[model samples]
Target chain A: MSAADLSRCSLNSATVKHASLTELVDAAAAAGLGAVGLWRHQVQEAGAEQAARAVAGAGLRVSSLCRGGFLTAADEAGIAAALEDNRRAIVEAATVGTRELIFVVGGLPAVSAPGQGPRPDAGPGDRDLVAARARVADRIADLVPFAAEHGVRIVLEALHPMFAADRAVISTLGQALDLAEPFPAETVGVVVDTYHVWWDPQLREQIARAGREGRLASYQICDWILPLAAEPLNSRGHVGDGYVDFAAISAWVSGAGYTGDVETEIFNEEIWADEPVATARTVGERYARYVRPYL
Target chain B: MSAADLSRCSLNSATVKHASLTELVDAAAAAGLGAVGLWRHQVQEAGAEQAARAVAGAGLRVSSLCRGGFLTAADEAGIAAALEDNRRAIVEAATVGTRELIFVVGGLPAVSAPGQGPRPDAGPGDRDLVAARARVADRIADLVPFAAEHGVRIVLEALHPMFAADRAVISTLGQALDLAEPFPAETVGVVVDTYHVWWDPQLREQIARAGREGRLASYQICDWILPLAAEPLNSRGHVGDGYVDFAAISAWVSGAGYTGDVETEIFNEEIWADEPVATARTVGERYARYVRPYL
Candidate 1:
């Protein structure tokens, strides 16, 4: 019942997206949160140095950097540019004193990195899947040395099915782990987000698999929306707000010897438009009631 | 290909929903289709007795009955009624000489049997996926004996995430198999509809597993529309229209040892508004292009 026990809790800045980087950090500290998670765009907008100073000043931990993915591009040059952008992201994470940079592997070549110029088109066939998957592994290999140099970990987050064509070829924890196998464990890890993975029957087994391999980088929670609309990426809800078994997952993470922070990361329009403090407070209280039972 | 070999293609009556049950059967036969799938309401409207005669008269095989699920009602009476209704459905399938009786397990009690009667309400916080699962198994247990007697198989269809709450508790092929294990394999089975299951990473493995277990009952195909509306059930597209790897699935089905008919079961507004012959020809041609590779 103690607020400090909220040590397990981390305020992913995406949850209180309306708040500026400084305001978000202050809100987390004021709410007695033990850690915070930041997004790269917000970090860039706030100035990485200023954001880092504010986070350290609040005596807060940066659980994870929002992301460094969408690597799929039309050509080799575009892919090279994506690798450079990811390296910069790793540097930004290092500046913020965080080691894990979450990766949402890009979807389709066009959608994942739209700014990249047009390239060859592949039909919707196994050959396309095989090529996309190979491209993902190759890019990860390219980024590994840069990630290693920064003492940073690359945590690939597998998205839901809708994004498979355009997003990550590695679309499940198992698939991500398979891609991570060739890389050093420390250099490549996985972020277990409830929103993307709760529907998986292999949830418990995969979490255990990640832990056993020492690949557990971040534990994130959101909700799974039903009757989903066109755009699958931005439809996430709050923990316990949808049909996912948050308590079961919380229990699984605890059992897996994962003592890291549990970050709340919702991408809903309704929640994002509300007051940031109100959002944080509601998230805090809900996590306590819905997730604490497992603890 | 010979028309008889081409005849193996079946029109899942849902493809030409605007056509009456008799017209669908007549069209399939005239087009030299080997089989057709029929829904209960369509049968009810056309009269199951008359529909059966028409299917037989056209020298058509009833590949599968459209559905007989939503067994997860709120009370004992509701449960009993569902069981009784399933028994009648088995008789109807037998009358039509169809081997498979497809079940779309009902969603949340309220949504499952809308306004049928008052029912017990389930909460969002309630994580009793176990109880819902048990109810599905229990209902199946009641119907297995009747299904066995009728020489008909009960195939539970895996629904999408949107229907997980109220429709079918068995939302995945693996989960559906788990629900089916207690029953005799000949009497209990699973229907693999690409629209419902194409997104599953475990699809190939599960389909292989179902084949090994000899529990794969039927294969249905429909397109999964991208940027789908909020509703999950109503947004299916025609065979070649969406992003699914239909050829790959056909390959999996063939590799998994299913020599049964592959039915096209589309429920799109555009196809529904088209002429029945146009819809049938479109489905047949699309199957030839996107799905015939495996066959």
Candidate 2:
């Protein structure tokens, strides 16, 4: 497939970990891909301005920024630090020329995340999910003005419920939208990631509702694989390698009137071990075969 | 706390895997737990009639049965076998003196579950979650008459979304309620298992809804522990050990007017390794400190 054939598909930077922002940009441009999605860490490592320049130099679009939300902090200092980091993230996202800054809104307090241990600075243990969720809202409200001023949409990504205990409080597109609805569409949005949400019963209606609300900031694709016990964070597969029905999901995205770039943000260890350019090419090929046709 | 304090705390048989039904019943009665929940496998191993006799002999009430639903079959033979097995499960539940028979509706097709391999009898492969869920509803419908005839309520247990692929497709208390509402309250009901549902955003409302509709069949508890990657099926901890705010959750269950036995269905390896009587005593102690107060 030509670059035009891969027009709507975007390779998320985390998918190819060894590559710097410049290398990812060049590889995406050379691999017949039209755009690349960047992670905040990668852009910061290369310096956001330099990363922006690299993408511009390669004539490729920056689809969206990888992440910018752990706003479930309960302590005052932790909350202050989280807001500061998010403000910096918004500035970096603006520098990278992507309006969407994804937020993995944090999970239940004190619970340890896989590999990444407990947040050292969280308040005296909070297990009240309701209170933690309310805190997430208040913190987002604090950041909305800064995000809007920087021309960035705070995009909420509802991870699979496995992460609900320690990674993300927002565990469904519906919940993400509930949080998003309180803010303007340009200031707050939600991501439709297939791997994270393929199991949700309300996904289709929620996708349409997201588009209708003009909060569909990003459309992401990745297959939900087997041997799920391997590791929650790295169990994703190529589009057709798992149980996700990409055709039906892509059609839902298209029906939602979302013409935005469909990004692949897989976290599998095996895919990360492969060559960057080859992985990018395979991502596009899988998108064309399993997703694009339905869209 | 005395045995009277543990009036509502029921120890699920899965927590004491090595013990035979007679031993478990004797231990529960000795441990001052008013009831002991039985699993179909244990009941079958001891003979359902013999299990019922042991429970009666020990003056211990049988709480809900462990499970009887993997009814996501797409083929005729598979569907027929599931119904047959469920009928036997109903008979076993009746024989064991429990009105409730729990169902863990199976997950997406061909995926390998933790420890348990893929079901060789499952159809070619069903990836459409919507279709699989619809199939679950259909199979449950097929089981209702038999269950009702046997004076058993077909109970649905919503697993955490982590198990949405290979263990259980029903992933929320609300989804379970939705499935349960279609049948008469006596014919179909839902379980409120804290470990599987503590993360849901709509849990409080759904709990109330389940109460209002008279579809709340079972109340089970087990702490949602840390180091979640240990194993999905065996990661449960003792009450108050993990991030579950049992006080608040028990308050909700009480507010919903649930007067039934609050069972503990923990599956932790460490807990199972302990002597059965000791484990039951610890379970009661934890329930008294963390859960009984709220109730």
Candidate 3:
């Protein structure tokens, strides 16, 4: 398939996670995918300006920045540090020419995050999920002006409920939209990642609500595989390889008036081991067959 | 602790899975638990009448039957078989002297159910989750009369969303309440298992709503432990061992007017390997410390 076959598809960096900044851009371009979702780590490694030039140089669009939220800090110092880092993330998003800056948003208070180790100093593990959710809303509010100034929207991504403890307190699209409703849609928006939200009972209603609110910033797709991995986070599959109903979800998004580029964001270990260009091409084929028709 | 110390506590059989029905009844009796939640398997193995007699002989009340709903089957045979099995489960619940019968509704279409192997003839994996959910509603409607006739309330248990693909399609209290609302509260009700729903943002309101509708049938507790086990089904912990805020959840349940036996139903491998009596007493101590005060 050529670029013409996958016009509306974007390859999320995590799909071919082994690929470096230069490698990913090249793979996306060679695979005939027109866009790439850049993670903050890769962007930082290449420096934002260089990364932007390289992406543009390859004739590809930057769909959105990977993440910048872990705002569930319990202590004052931790909270301040999280906000400061998010501010920097906004600047990087602006530099890279993508208005959307996805936020994985941290876990419940005092829990050990994946990349960040234990926060024993933060006091006993806080199971105040409501408080943590409120903290996310407040942090988004704090970053809204900065995000707006940088022309980057603080895109709220609700990780699946399974990750509510160690990855993100935001566990539903409805909750993310609630947090975004308080701000201008342009300044604060929510993502509709099928893998994280496909099982939600209120998904259709919430997707419609997100569209009506003018806060549907991005669309991410991946399949929910069976027999979860040893690490649940690595259990995602390619678009058609597992159990997600992409056609149904794509219709909902399209019905909601979201015409943005769809990003394929699989996190499977085996998929990552594939050649980056091959993975991108495979994502494009699956997206075309499973999602494009419905969209 | 004595029976007086945990007046409202019940030990679910799964908490001491290694014990036979006789041993479990005796262990729960010795541990001072005044009630027990019976799983259909053990009850089936011993004959429901004998199981009830044994529990009653130990001076233990049968709080509720473990489960009975896999109504999401796609094929006619699968659907009929599931309904027939659930009907038997209702009879078993009645024989065991419990008004409540919990349902862990089946997962997506065409997938191999945990105990049952693959369904190659069931056709390709059906991703019509909305359709699968609708099937559940229709099946529940079909079973309501039978459940009510036997003085059994068909209790909907919303398993954690992570289990949505393989275990239960019902994933939230609100969703469960919606399904239960079409029938009489005495005939159809919803369960609030804290392990399954503690992370829900709308949990407090939903619990209050479940109570308001007079459809809150059962209250089960266990902690949502960190580092989910390889088999996530066994990921639960004792009340005080994880990040769940039992005080907060218990207060909600109390405020919701659920004055019933609070069953401790942990499925941890380690806890199962412990001495049945020791595990029962440990569950009692944790429940008394973390959950009872607020209730």
Candidate 4:
């Protein structure tokens, strides 16, 4: 596994979130990586136009934009606001020169305002997950023309079920593909992130279906760490540190004919503490050894 | 929502883990509850035969046995040991006189023995979840004959996906039902515990399927609490306390024609801190308010 084998490797800016967009782009290019996946906040910090110019100047491809969806609001005002925000995200993705804009599709609406703690009046009867998910589907359909017009694809990422309530109601690749089915494959696709979907029983079949339908938008890699952190969001491990079968899953993705950027997107606090350049080098090496062979 | 409507309520002993088998039986009976679910250790402390006698003497039914399967071992000896333990559990379930013996089928075998922190040499490539799941299927087939002879149904309970690596690989009702399909539904079944499975997107369809197949062995109820505990196992909330929609899910189960015991099987430190009798009464009231109408 040499630097030459890392030609398809992409550094997701969130993996080294401490780094500025400029620093991530520079580190990724210096490490001989072919692409970089940018987060919305990081791109905004560098200014989307400047971020695009920097990546292009560094001779690196913009693999994808971090995210753009939170359409599960209980009220009309909230729904309208979410759609407006997503339309802006589509424009941002277009500005950053990436066709793939991942959408996490938010979870159930909050019963009360933030920091109110658990609602004392709340009961088991208040949540309607099915309705929340339906709203996500409808909102995605609404955003399809906007995204397509901007030449950006809406990549629906299925978060692990642990985040089903507060992060993403779409918890499996099959479900994401199901939601994406009504739209054009190029305009709406699904993300095959190993961190979220590795435990899925229907992973192989779903990946195959996504490939068959030309809906395999982006292939992201990360590990599932044990003793999950207090903030479960930061529990993702470096590629070789946890229990995901990356080689097998990567082979499935590669076999499905996905020839796109392979992003190493981790969210561990420990990994975030490392120097950006060193983290990029380490991730690149791991990707070469663990994932490149399969590809 | 009167005591008459509570005729199907059962106190799962784990919901009050501090209580002895005798105390559980007596409290459940005194509360006018119809049944009590027993755990093996609690029954052993009271002596299984004596425990059976006491429950009968108290005129209470044994709703189900707490557990019986951990067949995800990699080595032959480990696999044999697990099967042997499950055999004993089958006998214990029969002794306690309950047809439903719920199995929280264990997760992937540890790379090394206990107390060795995450295996340094282990990687995602080392764990074979597909093979581990296949072993669970094979072991369940091996135990079906014994369970049949004892007239005890082997109930496979899908633990939450967060427990996929260390607790139970059977992480969805659909997967559990798929595993149980090769065997007789009467000899092998699936436990639909709300805490473990409420996040599943295909939950309603799977519950309906479980009913149509007559394999809905146990209907356990508990809430999915927020800010999950440091140890996820203790995160189960009392019925009205968390985000689970009991009325909706229970309606689905009831609509499927399930008339079994509704076991309130919670595992929270806060709930366990209460007096056993008080806890039983509170749970009964909550069940009457939140779940009884649907049933």
Candidate 5:
């Protein structure tokens, strides 16, 4: 596949984080990329309108405006604030012609909302498992209508089980689907990131299930670092740098009926220090090389 | 819940790793522990017969062996050797009169079997999730007869997802139970470690499910370190030092009809630096204070 066939591959600004918001858009456009995912901080740094204009002027699409999923342990007041902030983000995404708001659900109450007082800690057994699930679903239910009014689809990203404690209460695709079952698939769906879900046993089937239900809101790719026991965090590898078979995963998602953009979301510290253009060019080429077969 | 209730608490030798096999057994007995879990290396160093004599002399029961799970993956022949070695473990466990053999199902064939050539890497999509699960069941099936002949139960330890790559493919209680579903719940069950399962949203339900089905083999306790994102690996805290709710977990297990031993299993580098007696004493006190409430 040429760069044009790979136009659907979006750059999640995180992949070239060294670049400022303006430079990131310029780099994406210069590279002939069609879509880009923005971080809220980046959007704020450049002024949302200015950033959106930069992408629009470059003829690049705003695939998704990341983040708005920390509803796990926020207080009523905090929740209200977060909802309002998310609404603003949605308006910004809309200004840039982005339709999806990606959610990286917060972990623990403290981590999710740093200033919040610690919630009561439960023992593994004391975890009112039923209540926790209900809490998550209820919070999402409350936020769904607000998100819908903004015409911005909310995509819950399923993190690894390791993050289950303080991060997202929803850890698996199945769990996310269960949460989304009550709402329309289009309004509330999941963003499938390879790095998080690759280790799951039910990946293929879950992707197919999501595809069948049209619940796959976003498709992001990142490789899993080997020797997982080595570096627990800040150890993400670029595509084909580690053990995951991109071709197989891409094939599965494609087969599952997901025709959405394949967003490259890399969270490695190593790549963050590189020159923006070099990072984007290299990663884009590699994804085109290693990940293109499946796409 | 004083020392009297400590009757159901077992000291996995690894918890007091500072001690030799004989010393660990001596320490447990000194603390009035009801049971003890031994490692193959510790047993080998002290001589299996002598180790068995020590436990008997201490009037302490052997809860389960530390491990015999890594089906060596260097080669087919090596894999066969591992099975044979597991048989030896069965004999050893029987000699010591322990009923359950804890299995830490090994990871990547090569890393799992250190001396083996490079093992094939996992795929992009839940790398070999299907194969790993099947292999675990098949390997256990192959060893079941030997275990049955010796009246030894096989407890597949459900590890955290981080270790899913090379430590144990059976990462969750649900996965472990699925592997145990075809086998007798008595013969095949799970070793639920607090550190591993505490983060799982489905933990309580799974524990209850395991108990209802008679699949709860052994219960282990430890604490999870805070600010986990800072240092993902090598940051496990002691029982009350971190965020896990041990008392609540203990209550859930006991409530689930699981009357088995609650083994203290800490894997902290800091504690390991101390002498075995001190570590064992600390574990004993914490087990009594924090865990007793749940019991």
Candidate 6:
């Protein structure tokens, strides 16, 4: 087994969120990396068309567009608004020259005021998770044509079940595939993020099934930390910093015929504080050590 | 659709951790509840024989034993020690006259030192969750015969996936049933705890399967609260106080022919601060209002 080549390494912008779109692009090229994953917020900050021109101008490939799905809204008006925003996201992904538009299908819609973040002390309401999930499926179906016409794919990312309440209702790759089964694989596929699916008992079988069905849209990597951050949303660790078995998981991912860019996507506050260039270098080195060998 | 009969209500001692075994038994009987679930710690505190006598004398049935399985140790010594501890728990349950010995099967063995709890800053070690799960299956097989001989059933409890690292590896009812399938239903069964299994996408199907197999050993209820406490283990709320839809879930339990005791097993700091008698009365009222009608 030789060392994993840097050709497949792509730095997700969220990994070094402090970096501007230009800084992320220049950093990846400066670090001798092959590609970069862009987030919509950062892209929107630079104007989507301008961000796409900058990446293309630098000769860097956009591995994926950060997000486009929050289809589970509390009301009919909210659902219509989400669909309108997602349509714009499809056009943005196409402009950025990335077919993969990752969808973090949202959880149960909040009943609170629009600007107020999730109230920690709020009691549970009549949020039907199953119904929220059904809305996601229907909304995705509604968007598939627009996404396909724009030469983009709807990439469904199943977050860890802990986030099932406020982040994403799709808690497993199997569930994601089940939702995607009725649609064309190229139009609606699933994201296999190790950070989310590593704890799953049926991971290997489901990853294999995802591959067999041609629904493996993306492969994101990050480690799972313990005594999770005060807000677990930022608990993702740098590669090799937490408890995920990268070697084993990567072997399964590679075995499933996935030859796409392996994006390092950490969301830790501690990692976000480090210098972007230094973090990218460290992430590359760790990926080579922990994940590359198996690949 | 009249009010649910209180004849089947059981107060799990942990729900009122501040209460002594005698107090719990007396409170449940005084509340006109038909049964009480005992934890080994409480039973050991009162002496199993004494606890048994107190419950019997109070005319209350021992609904089920709190737990007995932490079988996923990393070393032979740890495995042997866990087996010995579980063996004692079995005898304790039998001595207290309960046929169901509930098992909260332990998670990946810790590499940390004795008395040192899970380190928030610890790096990922070589803990293989799959292998640890295999060890749990093997250990449970080793304990099944002893459990059968003693006229007690090994009840597998699938905890929420958040506890997969330091607590329990069985993260879903489906996974628990898979582990229990190799053994006889009479000797091995699965617990249906709303707090643990409520997030599951396959809840209805799995609960039905457990019923069809005659393996629904215990049906415990508690609400899932949000802004989970710093230590998530104590985040359980009283019924109707959190997100779980008790009417929907309890109907499934009842349709499956689960005529056993409905144990209210809450573990919240707020709930624990209340007087035991008052807590019991509140729980009974909530159970009747939220879950009993469905059952």
lDDT of 2 by residue, B1-295 (tens): 5679998878899999888887788778878888989998898988998888888888778889978999887779989998998889999999889998899998875654543444455342467788889999999888888888899998899998878878899999989988877799988999999999988888899999988988888889998866664566888888877778787788888888889998998998888889999998988898888889988
Residue-by-residue lDDT tens digits, candidate 3, B189-220 = 99889889988888999999999999998999
- Give the clashing residue pairs of candidate 2, or none: none
3 versus 5: better TM-score goes to: 3
Worst 10 residues of 4 chain A by lDDT: A110-119
| Tens digits of per-residue lDDT for model 5, A78-190 | 66766677677767766666778887666655333332223445344333344455656777787788777777788888887766656666778877887888998768888
For model 6 the local lDDT of residue B94 reads: 90
Chain A TM-score values, per prediction: 0.92, 0.95, 0.96, 0.96, 0.89, 0.93
Answer with 4 or 5, whichever has the higher lDDT.
4
DockQ of 6: 0.38
- By lDDT, is 1 or 2 better? 2
Candidate 2 error regions (>4 Å): A112-125, B112-125
* Ranking of all predicted structures according to lDDT, beginning with the best and ending with the worst: 3, 4, 2, 6, 1, 5
Model 3's lDDT to the true fold? Answer: 0.88
Predicted candidate 6 versus true structure: per-residue lDDT over B195-253, tens digit per residue: 99887878888999999999999999997766677777887888876667687789899
The segments of candidate 5 whose C-alpha lies over 4 angstroms from its true place after superposition are: A110-133, A227-232, B72-74, B110-127, B228-233
lDDT of each: 0.78, 0.85, 0.88, 0.87, 0.75, 0.84
Worst 10-residue lDDT window, candidate 6 chain A = A110-119
lDDT of 4 at B162: 83
Off by over 4 Å in 1: A72-75, A110-127, A225-231, B72-75, B108-125
lDDT: which candidate is best? 3
- Model 5 RMSD, rounded to 1 decimal: 3.3
* Candidate 6 segments whose C-alpha is farther than 4 A from its true place: A1-4, A110-125, B1-4, B111-125
Model 1 per-residue lDDT tens digits across residues B59-98 = 8888899788877765889888888888888888887678
Better of 1 and 5 by TM-score: 5
Q: What is the DockQ of each candidate?
A: 0.31, 0.51, 0.51, 0.50, 0.34, 0.38
